[model samples]
Target: MLKCDFQYQHADFSLNVELEMQQSLLGIVGVSGSGKSTLLKNIVGLLKPDQGYIQFNQHILVDTRQNIHLPMHRRKITLIFQQALLFPHLNVKQNLCYAEKWLAPSERKFQFDDIVDLLDLNGLIQRKARQLSGGEAQRVSIGRALLSSPNLLLLDEPLTGLDVQLKQQILPFFKRMKDELNVPMIYVTHHLEELEYLEADTLQLNHGQLQHN
Candidate 1:
């Protein structure tokens, strides 16, 4: 379970939201700059809230009152950014192995070969990140995150740069990851079609505040 009841004040706007959700894909939908990404950043511990708390699976990840704020890496949450930010210098195999370094020997759950097969990345393993197409790069990015074995995943408009056909092609992989992996996800997008495809429990935001619970 994940619960958030927090507020942050900006120079021109204030974001206040409260939500509770379980292990399921939760979609955050809104126009650009409606606090959708802001809320995601907070959940991932990239941004701190001025008040209230963020609890994940009963662990107090953030609590202003208790002065508790776990660092981004300590949150066990992986974020897939708008751009598939693969390291330009690294090959697909190297990028996938980077996250494995963070796991303890006993805690390492995912195997490299399994991830390559799951993401259909066998052919691209030796290719450099810069050599991949847009869709391929995104696949590598997702595979990298999965290799980390994250408890929660945040996808912030991951399809933004892709064309319609590419979006359709990659979306099934997202669904496969959700169903096969059972990893909870928070997907942020403005496109209603994406929401329809995801069929996720949704929270609507407008003007930096949640309009729907």
Candidate 2:
């Protein structure tokens, strides 16, 4: 489970949110700059809260009063940005292997071949990261994150730049990742169509606050 009650301030906006999420896909919906991405970043430890706490499975990732703040790598949370963000010099397989290094030998839960198969990445394995199409790159990115065995996956408008056809192509794989892999995810998007396909519980953000129905 994940629980958070935190606040952060920016030059133009302040983020104040409290939310409790269990082991399931939880979708965050809001307009651009409504603090949705900031919330995810905070939970993932990319940003520290000015006050309050963040707990995941009883681990206190951040507690201002206790002066506890875990770094991003130690938190075991993965954030997938809107862009694929693959290493331009690395091949697809190399990118995936980069994350695999973080997993303990005994805890390495995912097989490389299995990830390739799951993401339909066989044909792109040998290709340079720059050679892949947008969809292919994003697939590689997702596969790489999965190889790391993250406890929580934060997707920040992953499908934003894709065309409708490409978005449709990748949608099934997201479902496969959620259902077949059972990796709890927090997907941030403004699009309701994508949320419907996820069939996840909704956490709506408005004026920097999180509201659930």
| All candidates: TM-score | 0.96, 0.97
Across 123-178, the per-residue lDDT of candidate 2 in tens digits comes to 89889999999999999999998999888889999998999999999999998888
Q: What C-alpha lDDT do the candidate models reach, one value each? A: 0.88, 0.90
Residue 59's lDDT within candidate 1 is 91
Highest TM-score model number:
2
Q: Give every collision pair in model 2.
A: none
- In model 2, where do residues sit more than 4 Å from their true spots? none
**Cα lDDT tens digits for candidate 1, 1-213:** 899999987788789988888858988889988887788889998899999999999899999999999999889999999999889999999999998987887776678888788889999999999999999999999999988988999999999989999999999888887777778999989997787787888888989788653
The clash count for each model shown is 0, 0
Runs off by more than 4 Å, candidate 1: none
